[model samples]
Target: MSTQPPSAPVAEPPPAGWEEARSRVYAVGLAAALPSTPRPLAEADGHTLAEPLTTRTDLPAFPTSSVDGWAVRGEQPWRVVGRVLAGSTPAPLTSDGTTVEIATGAMVPEGTTAIVRIEHSARDPEGLVTGVPRPRPEWRLPGEEARAGEELVASGTPVDPALIGLAASCGQDTLQVRRPPRAALLVFGDELLTSGPPADGRVRDSLGPSVPSWLRRYGCQVRAADVVGPVADTLPAHVAALRSALGTADLVCTTGGTMHGPVDHLHPALEALGADHVVNTVAVRPGFPMLLARVTSDDGRVRFVAGLPGNPQSAVVALVSLVAPLLAGLQGRQLPVLPQVTLAEPVPGRGDYTHLALVRLDRATGTAYPVRHVGSAMLRGLAGADGFAVIPPGTSGSVGDRVRVVPLPLLPGERTW
Candidate 1:
C-alpha cells in the first residue's frame, strides 16, 4: 500500500491587532451542536438543555405549612385534632375550633385557614392550642412559586445543580440536554514531561494537566485517556495525532507548535489535513501566535482546532482568547461578560499588540495590579492572579484605568469574589 504525500504549508500573515483576529474567527463561524440525549437528572449537571423544560406539577404540590406550630381552622384555644408530618396525610378538622400540629413543609389538613408559629402559640395542660394568628396565612399554597405546565427553563439553559434539583422536584427523572462538546488535547513539544521536575533541557508538561481542566470549565468533555501527545517533532506525528483526535472529538486543542520555528510542525500538519484557518493568529502580547482552524471530516462533521502557545501562561491566555468563545458558541451560550476593573498601576503597551497582563485584583476593591513573574513561560503570576487585565494596543495603562478583565476558573469550593 502506498502512503499519501503531505500538502504544502500555507504562510498567512495575521492582522496586527487582537480585535481583527477575533473578528476573523467570529466570521468563520465554526459553531455546531453536539448530539442531544436524555440524561438522568442525577447526571445532568453542566449539560445544556436542548428543549424548553416545563414543570410537571405545581411547586409545593399541596397546601403546606410554613411554620412548625398549629394548623388551625378558626380562632385561638382550639382542640388538637391530629398531627401532620412532612410525608404523611393528616385527618380533616371537623370542628371550627380544631387544629393540627404541623411541621414545616408538612401538608396541612383540610379546613386549615391559618398557621400559628410555635413561639406565638401555647399548648395548655388540657391539650388545647391558643395563639394570635398573624394577619397573613403562613400556608404555602400549591403552585405558589411555579404553576404546573409553566416553562421552568428555556432551551439552551445550562443544567446546573440547582436546575437539576428543580427538574427533579417537578417530576423530571430525566432531562433532554445537549451533549458536552468532546475535545482532544495535543501538547506538541518533544521536551515536555508526563511526570517529574524540569531537568537537562526538559520541562514538566503543564498543558497536559492544565488544558484538560480548563476545557472542562469551558464545557468540553475531555476524558483522561484522550489528553494524549506532545506529538514527536515530526510533521507526520503531528498530522497523525490531529487526524486521530478529529475522528472522535468535535474540538481539538494543540498546545505549542503555533509559531513558525524549525520544530513547529502545526501549520504543516494543518495544511496536510486541508484545515481552513479561522483565525491565524492574534496580535496580543505573550500569546500573539494563537490560532483557530476548522477541519471538515469526510462524514460532514466540522471539527474545530485551537492552537495554543508553548509557554504556560501564554497557552492559558490563548485558550481564553479563542477556545472559551468557541466552546460557548457550540453550547449555545452567550459570550461571558468581562468585568470592568481599575488598574492599580501603569501597564506598558507592546506597539500594536494587545497586552493581557496577569493581575491580582483587590479582593475588596476590584482594583487590578500586575502580578510579579508574568513572563509567558511562567505560571506563578497566573496561579496567584484573579484575572487578566486587558490593556489595549499602543498605549500604556495608567493608574486607575478602567479595563475589562477575564477571570480565571473558580476553584473547587470557591465562589465568585
Candidate 2:
C-alpha cells in the first residue's frame, strides 16, 4: 500500500466577500475554542460561560413577604404574637386572631392566612391590629422568580455585573467559563515613531498602544509586554517576531505588511511558518488587504495570525471586521449581531466592495450621520465616531435608509454620544 504525505499549503484564493471572510474566521476560531475552566464570580466578569447558569436552589428559597405588613391568621383585628425581620424565621400562627409584624423580604411564617400593609392597618390601645387585606397575596411564594435547577443564563453568554448578581442569588460562587485567549501585537514598520509627534518622515505608531485596548474590550488577555513595535522591516525579523509571539499567544496581530509592497514581508513570513490562509483578503473598502492565517506547532498546538493594514483607520476596520468575530468564537460566543440605524444623510457605496463609512450615531434620534476626516489612513474621524455604517456592495445608502452599524466596543463605564 502507498502512503501519501500531508498536502502542502496552497495560495489563498481571490478576495473573499466581506461577510464571508468574517464567517470563515469565526468558524475557524470556534473549532479551536479554548478549554473551559472554573472561575470565581468576582473574576469571571468579561468572560464567556462554558455551561448554562442554573439555579442551585429555588429563587427566594422560602415564602417571603413582599411588603412591610402584618402577617395575620384567620382574620383582621388580630392580637400581635411575634415579629419577623429580614433573614429571620418566625413561628407558625398557632391560633386564630393572631398576627406577626413582618418586614419586606422576611420569610412568611407557616399557617399565615394573609398580609395587611402597615399603612392599611390600625392598632388601638387594646394592642390589636385591624386592616382589610387586598385580594391579591402580598407575599412571594418559593420559586417565584425561578425553580431549583432552572437555567437562568444560557451557555456562551458574556458575564456582566448583573449576571454576577444573578449567579450569586442562585447560590453560585464560581462559574464555568472559557478562558480568555491570550494575544500579542506586532507592529511592523521601520518608519514609525514610538513617542512624541511624527517627525523626519516617520509617523507615530498608533496601533501599538491602541490595538491592545481594543483587544481587551473584545475579551482577549493582552499584556503590555506582549505589544512589540517597529520590528525591523526584514523577512527574518518578521519570522522571528511571529515565532516568539506564537510561542505564548493563541493569536498574534501584526500591523502593516499585509499588502505586497516593497518592504512587505508578512506573507513570506507566514509561508515560512507553514501557515494556512483562513482569509487572504476581504471585499471591503479602506481595509481590503486584511488577512487571517492559521499556524500549527510541532506539538500540535494551533495559533492564529491576523494581518491588519498599516493605515490607522484601516487597521481599526480590520479589527472590527476580522479580530472581533474571531475572539468571540474563541470564547465560545455566538457571532455578534449588528444593530440597525437610520441614515441621516446619503452615503456612497464602493462598487463591488462593502463600504464601512465612519459615522457618529445620534442615539436620541436613532440616526447615523457621516463624520469628517474618514480617509483610509486618517484617525481623526475614527476617534470621533461611534461606529461604522455599512453600505452593502452595489447599493448606495440614501437619506432615511436603514443600515447596519458596526459598533465600537466601549470600555467599561465609557460612553460615546
How does each model score on TM-score? 0.89, 0.93
Which ranges in model 1 have alpha carbons more than 4 Å from their true place? 1-11, 20-30, 88-94, 195-197, 411-414
Error of 2 at 386 (Å): 1.3
Cα TM-score of candidate 2: 0.93
Residue-wise lDDT of candidate 1 within 1-417, one digit each (tens)?
Answer: 758788878657754467666544544432566667999998888788987888889997899888899988877789987889999988887789999889998998987888899899888899898999889888899999899999988887777888888898888899998878899998888898889888989999998998899888777788988888768999989999999999998889999989889999999899999999888778898898888989997888888889999999999988878887777667765566778889889898887889888888887987888999999999988889888888888888899899888788663235574
Of the candidates shown, which would achieve the greatest lDDT relative to the real structure? 2
Residue pairs with backbone overlap in model 2: none
State the C-alpha lDDT per candidate: 0.84, 0.93
Clashes of each: 1, 0
Best by TM-score: 2
Pairs with steric clashes in candidate 1: 187-230
What is the lDDT, from 0 to 100, of the residue 383 in candidate 2?
90
